[model samples]
Target: MKPEQLQASGRRTLEIERDAFAGLLERVDAHFAEACTLMLGCHGRVVVTGMGKSGHIGGKIAATLASTGTPAFFVHPGEASHGDLGMITPQDVVIAISYSGETAEVLTILPLIKRMATPLIAMTGKPASTLARIADVHLDVSVAKEACPLNLAPTASTTATLAMGDALAVALLEARGFTSEDFALSHPGGSLGRRLLLRIQDLMHTGDRLPRVAPGTPLTAALLEMTQKGLGMTAIVDADDRVVGVYTDGDLRRSLEDQIDLRSATIDQVMTRGGKNARPDWLAAEAVQLMEKHKITALLVTDDQLHLQGVIHMHDLLRAGVV
Candidate 1:
C-alpha cells in the first residue's frame, strides 16, 4: 500500500472505533445499573471469563475491577470446564464475555454455573444470544461494524467491550467511595502509589538527624547544626522543645548583609519566627503542595501542640518519588 493509503487506513480504523465506543453511552441503561448493583452486593470475588479476543478484554476488565475496589479475577472459560470450575462459588458473581455470545467453551460451563446458583453477568453483542438469555444481567457491548477492511477482526468490537468494562469499573468505584488512597493500597509498587500512600512521618527526619538549636544558641552553632544535619536549616526551640523559630540559609545571607557577627549573634535574634509546618500524618504529596504554596523547601513536622516531631525537605520528596 502507498503512504497515503496507510494513513487513510489508520484514520478510518480510529474513527470507526471511536464511534463504536461512543455508542456505549446510550446503552448505559437500567441493565448497566443492575450489573453494578449485583457486583457491589456480591459477598465473594467477581470471576471474569471469556474466549479468544473477548478473553483478552475480560482479563483487562478483571484487573480494572480488582484495582479499583471490587475484588475480581479472570478465569479462562476453557479452564473452567476442567477443575478450575471449582474456583467459582455460590457467593461470587461471574462475568462472561463473548462477541457472538455462543462461545462453546463458555456455553459448556453455563449448566454448572446455574447449578451453583451463582449470578452470571454476560457481555455480548447479541442481546438474544443464549449466554445473554441465561445470564442474570446482560451488558450489550454491540458495535455496528469492525474497523478491519475485511470486517473480520475484533477491532471496534473489542474496543467497545473495553470501554464498557471501564465504565463499569469507574461507576462501581464511585458507588463504593473508593478514594485515591484506597487505590494506592492495591497499587503500591509505582510512583503513583508513593505519591498517594507516603506520609510525612514515613520520610521525615527525626531524633538526632533533625537540625535544631536552643533559642539563645549562637548563629555559628546553628549554622554548624544545619551543615551537620544537611537540611539547609535549623529549628530553634524553647526549653519545652516547642519550635519558636527557624533559621535557613536565606536568613544567613541577610545576616551577612547586616554585618552581624556570626560568632556573637544568637540564632533567636536572626531566625524567622513561626515557620510553616505540617502534621506527621499528612500525605507527603500534601507537603509538596504546602511547600509550593509557601515557596519553601523544608517544613517542620509537628503535633497539635506545635512540638517538633520531625522535618521534611523537598529533596526527601524527590527521593521518595512523591514530588
Candidate 2:
C-alpha cells in the first residue's frame, strides 16, 4: 500500500472509533447506574471474564477498577471452564464481556455462574443476545461499523467497550467517595503517592542540624550558625527555644547595603518577624504549595506552642520525591 493509503486508513479508523464513543454517550442511562450500584454494594470482588479481544479489554477494565478502590480481577472464560470458576463466590459480581454476546467459552460457564447465584453484568453489542438476556444488568456497547476495511476486525467496538468500562469505574469511584489520599494508599510506589503521603517531619532537619540562634545573638554569630548548618537561613528563638523570627541570606544582603556592624547588630533586629511555618504532621506537598504561594524556600516545623521542632527546605522535598 502507498504511504498516503496508510495515512487515510489510520484517519478512517480514528473517525469510526470517535463515532462509536458518540453512540456510547447516549447509551449511558439506567443500566449503567444499575451496574455501578451492584458493584458498589458487592461484598466480594468483581470477577471479569471475556474471550479473545474482549478478554483484553476486560483485563484493562479489571485493573482500572482494582486500582480505583474497587476489588476486582480478570478471569479468562476458557480458564473458568477449567476450574477457574472456583474463584467466584456467591457474593461476587461478574462482568462478562463478549461483543457478539455469544462467545462459546463464556457461554459454557453461564450455567455454573447461575448455579452460584452470582449477579452477572453483560457488556455486549446485541441487547437481545443470550448473554444480555441472562445477565442481571446489560450495558450496550454496540457500534455501527468496524474501523477495519475488511469489517472483520474488532476496532470501534472495543474502543466503545473500554470507554464504557471507564465510565463505570469512575462513577463507582465517585459513589464511594474515593479521595486522592485513598488512591495514594493503593498506589504507594508512584510519584503521586510520595507527594500525598510524605509528611514534613519525615524529611525535616532536627536537633543539631537545625540552624537556630538566640534573639540576643549578634548577626555575626547567626551567620556562623547558618554557615555551619548549611541551610542558608537561621531561626531566632527565645530562652525557651520558641521561634520568634527568621533571618535568611536575603536579610544579610540588606544588612550589608546599610553598612550595619555585624558584630553589634543583634539577629532579632534584622530577622524577618513571624516566618511561615508548618506543623510536624503537615503534608510535604502542602508545604511546597505554601512555599510557592509565599515565594519562600524553607519552612520551620513547629509544635502547637510555636516551639521549633525542625526545619524543612525545598531541597528536602526534592530529595524525598515529595515535590
Candidate 3:
C-alpha cells in the first residue's frame, strides 16, 4: 500500500473504534453497575471465558482485574468441557464473551454453568443472541461497524469488549478501595512496584556502613571518615546522636578557598547545618525528588527526634531502580 493509503486506513480504523467507545459509554448504566456489584459480591474468583478474539480480550481483562486487587482469572470456553469446568465454582461469577453470541463451544457449557448456580454475565454485540438471552446480566458491546474494509474482522466489537472489561475492573477496584500500594503488592517485581513499595530504610546503608562523625571532630578527621565510607560525605551528629550538619566534598572546596586549617577547624564550624534529611519510612522515589530539588547526592535518614537512622545516596536509588 501507498504511504497515504496506510495513514488513511489507520486513521479510519481509529475513528471507527472511537465511535464504538462513545456508544459503549451510553450502555454503562444500571446493568453495568449490576455486573460490577455481582463481581464484587462474588465469594470466589471472576472467571472470564470467551472464544477466538473475544477470548484474547477476556484473558487481558482477567489479568487487569487480577493485578488491580480483584481476584480474577481467565478460562477458555472451548476447554471448559474438557475438565476445565471444575475450575468454576458456584460462588464464582463467569463473564462469557462472544460478539456473535452464538459460539457453539461457549453455549455448550452454559447449561453446566447454570446447573452449578453460577452467575453468568454476557458481553456480546448481538443483544438477541442465545448467549445474551441466557446471561443473568447482559453487557451490550455492539458496534455499528468493523474497522475492516470488508466488515468481516472483529475490530470495533473487540475494542468495545476490552473497554467494557476495563470499565468493570475499575469499578470493582474503586468499590474495594484498592490503593497504589495494594497494586504494588501484586506487582512487586515490576518498576511500579519498586517505586511505590520500596522505602528509604530498605535501601539506606546503616550501622558500620554509615559515614558519621562527631560535631566536635576536626575537619580533617571528618574528611578521613568520608573517604573511608566513600559516600563523598559524612553526617555530623551531636551527643544525642542527632544530625546537626553534614560535611560534603563541596564544603571542603569552599573551606580551602578560604585557606581554613582542616586540621584545626571543627566540623561544626564548616559543615552545612540544617541540611535536607529524610525519614527512614519515606518512599525512595520521594527521596529522589528531594535530592533533585536540593541538588544533593546524599541524604541522612533520621527519626522524629532527629536521631540519625541511616544514609541514602544517589547510587543507592539507581541500584534500586528508583529513578
What digit string (tens of lDDT, one per residue) describes model 1 on residues 129-172? 99999999999999999999899999999999999999999999
Q: How many clashes (backbone atoms < 3 Å, residues ≥3 apart in a chain or on different chains) does model 2 have?
A: 0
Q: Which ten residues in a row have the lowest lDDT in candidate 2?
A: 260-269
Instruction: Residues 1-323, candidate 3: write the lDDT tens digits.
Output: 99999999999999999999999988999999999999989999999999999999999999999999889999998888899999999999999999999999999999999999999999999999999999999999999999999999999899999999999989999999999999999999998999999999999999999999997898888899999999999999888999899999888899999999888898988999968899999999999999999999999999999999999999999999989
Candidate 1 global CA lDDT score: 0.95
Q: Write the per-residue lDDT of candidate 2 for residues 163-279, one digit (tens) a residue.
A: 999999999999999999999998899999999899998999999999999988888899999999998899988989898999998889999998888889988789999899999
By TM-score, how accurate is candidate 2?
A: 0.93
RMSD (Cα, Å) of model 2: 2.0
Q: Give the TM-score of candidate 3.
A: 0.97
lDDT at position 146, candidate 2: 94
Top TM-score prediction, candidate number: 3
lDDT of each: 0.95, 0.94, 0.94
Superposed model 1: Cα runs more than 4 Å off: 1-3
The residue ranges of model 3 lying beyond 4 angstroms of the native Cα positions read none
